[model samples]
Target: MTYCVGMVLEKGLVLMSDTRTNSGVDNISVFRKMFTWQVPGERIITLMTAGNLATTQAVISQLEERTKEPDERDNILLKSPTMFQVATEIGRLMRGIISERQDANGVKGRGRFTASIIVAGQIKGMEPRLFMVYPEGNFIEASLDTPFFQIGETKYGRPIILRGYDRQMSLEDAAKLLMVSFDSTLKANLSVGLPLDLQVIERDTYEAGHQHRIGHDDSYFAAISDGWGDALKNAFHSLPDYSFYRPDD
Candidate 1:
């Protein structure tokens, strides 16, 4: 399992993903879950993937290869005139790949090749956008009502985002919020171990403002984790005590 989030804000986009893959408790490894392509000042796209490692890697590889081959049909980087179209293309690719794998394996029920992705970026003349692509090649864009999307082992971290997210918050605050969410997930689930990848894209810049890999020993993340735990505990204690002593009966 993995955890990945893509958030759309008034400022731009913030994306994060963990890099752990495991077949069993005894077998574990780290593989990058974040991928990016940029055309200098023209456009920048970032993708974070979750679910079956083979399926996700295959999709990313095909997209990368298409970018390199000028004659390839409607590759992710070339054919999409808008961020929406880019997401559509990726969804189509993911569905096609999973279907082919399922057919080859003669599998029934949900196929083992299921996966999802978060696609976030901006084009030269368009507003920044973020999307969550499902296994069936369908997707939903982030809107004012819902300014963020998360994929993969998400439940453990969602509450933090729900309580803390602010569309107008500065990128620095957004990053800190994500760190708290990720720290909570890491503490609760062994499958979501770290060496996280994060990207911040400022609106209209068509370039990534910050891209970083946070390892287990990153001091800032450590501080955020420790501080968030203390803060939450303190808040819990400060809440007004329940009126259980009121003897109405």
Candidate 2:
């Protein structure tokens, strides 16, 4: 299991993903779930993945290979003229892999080769965009009505983003908001452990502006975790006390 989020903002895009994967309580390990490809001033695409590790890794490796060997181009990430095309090609690759695996294994392999992906980036002369691609190879884009996407262990942290996300917030603030959300999830689920990879793509820059890893010992993340816990306690206490025995009763 993992936790990954991609947010769209007026300023640009923010992406974060945890690095933990486990077969069980005793077999936990860390593997990077975020991958970025860029053409500097032309385009920058970031993808965060969750689900079957092998499925995700194979998809990523194929995409990377296309970059190195342009002659094998069916649909290269850099060759795509728009972000939509980039996502379509990725979906095609992922779907093909899952389908091939399932077909080879027959009925028992139905859900075994599943995965999900969040794609976020900007192409020259266009507004930054964000997408959540499903295991079925279909995807939905982020817009004013839906300005963010999260894949993997999402339920635990979704409320925080729902309450705090602002379309006009700075990239810095968006990162902070996601940190709190991830902290909440981290506390609730042992499967989604740190360190987390965070990246910010500022609109029109066509490149990642900020990239970081927040480890277990990172002071800033520690502070945010502690502070959020304390703040929640204070907020809960601040609400008016409920009275079972009221005068009207």
Q: Which model scores highest in lDDT?
A: 2
Candidate 2 residue-wise lDDT at 102: 88
- Candidate 1 per-residue lDDT over residues 103-214, each given as its tens digit: 8999765768899999999999999988899999999988998999988888999998999999999998898889999999999999998899999999988887898999
* Candidate 1, residue 34: lDDT: 91
lDDT of 1 at 146: 93
TM-scores across all candidates? Answer: 0.94, 0.94
Model 1 TM-score (2 dp):
0.94
Candidate 2, residues 48-164: lDDT per residue as tens digits?
999999999989888767456677655377888998998898899899989988888883544888999999999999889898888789999998999999999999999989999
Q: Total backbone clashes of model 1?
A: 0
Cα misplacement distance, residue 241 of candidate 1 (Å): 1.3
Clash count per candidate = 0, 0
What are the lDDT scores of the predictions, listed in order? 0.89, 0.91
